[model samples]
Target: MARGRRLMARDGVRPSYDPAGPDQALRAALQDLRTGRWMAMRALLADTTQWWRWTQRTQILAAAAAGTDVVRAWLAEEPGNVHAAVMHARVLVERALRARRERHRRTHELWIEAWDAAQSATATAPRDPVPWVCLLALAQLDPEQRWEEHRAAAPEPMLPPGPWGLLAEAGRRDPDNREAHHRMLQFLYVRGGSGRLAEAAGYAQWAAGQAPPGAAAHLLPLYVRVERYRRDSGHDAALDLHWVGDEAAREARRGLHSWFENTQRAERSLSDLNHLAHALWGSLQFSDASRVFEAIGPYFTPPPWMYRTPDRERAVEIFVQARDRCRAAADG
Candidate 1:
């Protein structure tokens, strides 16, 4: 709407990589963790009741706390604390993944340590899905599928065997766990080749189908579409067609209905919101995209947008253009 545009312009709504969006408590907790303090992280995790929020906050905090001894200190101060134990696994997994990215010689050792921590956390915090998600995170680092559990048979013949057992454990603890599905997709990507796209797409559809109303799982298809686009070497015209295709539109609509419409704004994943907005805008569902853009506010994840352009500034420009056009269309 023109009103929406004016409000956005007046407020200068810009994209940011703010780890804590609309959650001041998380922001403060992250700050404290960065300063090597664990109390705020401790309190925040204690107060976070929602599984999705718990999973998200722990992963974010783990990333920030990985370089410090905050998690270790917390564990030492409160032995057998489930939150600290799970977070220790998360930080170790984060370190392992980072080591893998950097081609560090210690990657395998870190991965094994992370796996052990996560496995221990599962016993300590059986009802919490974060530990299972932590194990799923490690699944990608083992591309050879060396672990028997990682080579579990796929539910459908079309899909490849992967860490389905880890995913199932996460789902058992928290159905439609967002990070768990994404971790599986990361493994599929590591599998490499055109076949990876099919695996990812099939996996996305399977997950989306089982998703309940208000679950972030509905956005999986949109992410797969982006992955496909990223893999394709097509020109602008072909890429445009890919985005506005029947299937793309259908996925966007399903996400809007099954997830966006049913979930509260504060509860939505910032990454999921960005993907939904990107898909809706790409599919020419401007009105629907406008709503998603509004929900996104200033919180923007690099992903799905960065897939458009490798240049950070260009990606931001593209994001802003799509958002403005959607707002204008809704207004008209």
Candidate 2:
């Protein structure tokens, strides 16, 4: 069993966030769609839809994250394309989120536009969970009371009646949708007050238990942990790995053994691997941490690593050093 231990930084210089390079495939796909390769883009979306549903959803989200313009153009070219509609709604919701984060003056207007797009998508693809997921994400932007009033006033309540209703619809459409569950967890996190973080943790644990064996949903608790740490460590210069408790270590170990170690599909998500590596390193399982680092290779996600600092470059630097230290200890 791995005992809990702190992995300290070398050189005593903390790192900061710098924008990382774009994912080439996602970038290229967005470019292709934007630059008149409509047939190719359609084929690509079709191919993704034929893949594992989770992968399809993730890829759609990735494409949507690239930009709304390409997806909008696709929608205009093929007005009845369900994929285009869903992606367009997702992009609008993402833009709404960005506007909220940046404190843009027209944030509410963006949210309304997102809500409209999501509703249209839902109508176009009644069986698709992706549109419901977008609606749930959009609902999360406002307080429940505010959203309730908005929903009541809306011509058609863009989403299903309520947050739970939207979530249930998403689940009904696809029971194994991790993104849908994640959206609910975020909703709960946003709604809770002083005990919000703890509530989020409880929800995460429950969701993980409800998920199929070896599913990535087991990693949800780690996300909660990262969020909690980020909130508590506000403006702190360095993150003390010791902040991660024994229970979290045990849970991380269980998650690794049950969902990560034996599952071939776990390789699809570098973010999950990064979280696992961070947990294992903090728990003094250097050898296990080393293995995860080997899997991660050149890619890094800046969440739990940068929970202390918003700097992506600094996060990558610390991640590399920590991985190196773990590998050395494991090899010795």
Candidate 3:
């Protein structure tokens, strides 16, 4: 009878409690989480759980959400189960999300901790979408740094060519998933540094129609582009350089501007023009920059930018200087 019971215990799911070394902290974290005993989990990882350890550093945080303890004991018992690992990560992420909703002064701090835990889990398991999911969450909170990291470190190209691709596949698998939509939206309207604009444009079109109302804030610039591209037969640098497509190729095919008159009717976003102007200036496309300045000149009032806040403040000054330079060169 004792032998049979012991054998049965062997077959049952165990929690991660590996004591071999620090590298097995994520395993230990999963173990702690399964035990439903937070104290035990804390004991298992005591002294070993240090910040930037990245593995043990962020485990069993779901305790706040799950209202369980004994995360450490669970790990000591069951060390190698991938399903458990995923479950543990999900719990933490959900908890993090919840915390973000009812946040107070310490909200960003909790989010940071949760993000760290998620990233650590992702680093441990690269292929799983859960970590990517969590990292995507973190991107909202710290996108400038986080997206830069994802773009710099992603295993694939910043954006791939195939349909049902990274952002597309995420949208398809979870259509109602705000996360997938939000991430791809961010991918579409990237401001600066290492974004693949062509792929970003593809994501914009794929994301345009059914992406969700929450994407409205992001849609303004893309809408204006789809508009400008349609009306401006002469301004095709983006289309020509990347082979994005003709203006007729846009999903809605509605022009943003009227060729009969040079006025723009859409809601204006100054930050969009600021980024566009800088990008064009960098490429020596003064004509494109001039068009951008002319189109968005009506709304160039003060506002904040995600990356280039200061530079955006100086746009009128910069545009004035550029305009004078172009005028001088044209006559000379």
Instruction: Score each candidate by Cα lDDT.
Output: 0.88, 0.67, 0.42
Clashing pairs for model 2 are: 16-311, 17-311, 17-312, 18-312, 18-313
Q: Tell me the lDDT of model 3 at 47.
A: 48
The sequence of per-residue lDDT tens digits that candidate 3 reaches over residues 1-332 is 66335323422421122222223444455565565544434444344422222221332344332545333245455656443454466455556555655665666776776667666665565554545555554443443454344444322454442212343333333343434444555443443434445655655555454434323223333433433444343555454322134432232112122110232323223444444444344344555445554555334423212122236545444444544453344445
Ranking of all candidate structures by their TM-score, best first: 1, 2, 3
Error of 1 at 5 (Å): 13
Candidate 2 Cα errors over 4 Å, as ranges: 1-27, 31-39, 50-68, 148-162, 192-195, 234-244, 265-267
| Cα-lDDT of candidate 1 | 0.88
True-vs-predicted CA distance for residue 4, candidate 3, Å: 57
Sequence-dependent TM-score of model 1 = 0.94
- Candidate 1: list runs displaced more than 4 Å: 1-8, 192-195, 233-237
Global CA lDDT computed for model 3? 0.42
Candidate 3, residue 278: lDDT: 40
* Stronger candidate by TM-score (2 vs 3): 2
Off by over 4 Å in 3: 1-77, 143-147, 150-179, 186-204, 207-332
TM-score of each: 0.94, 0.79, 0.31
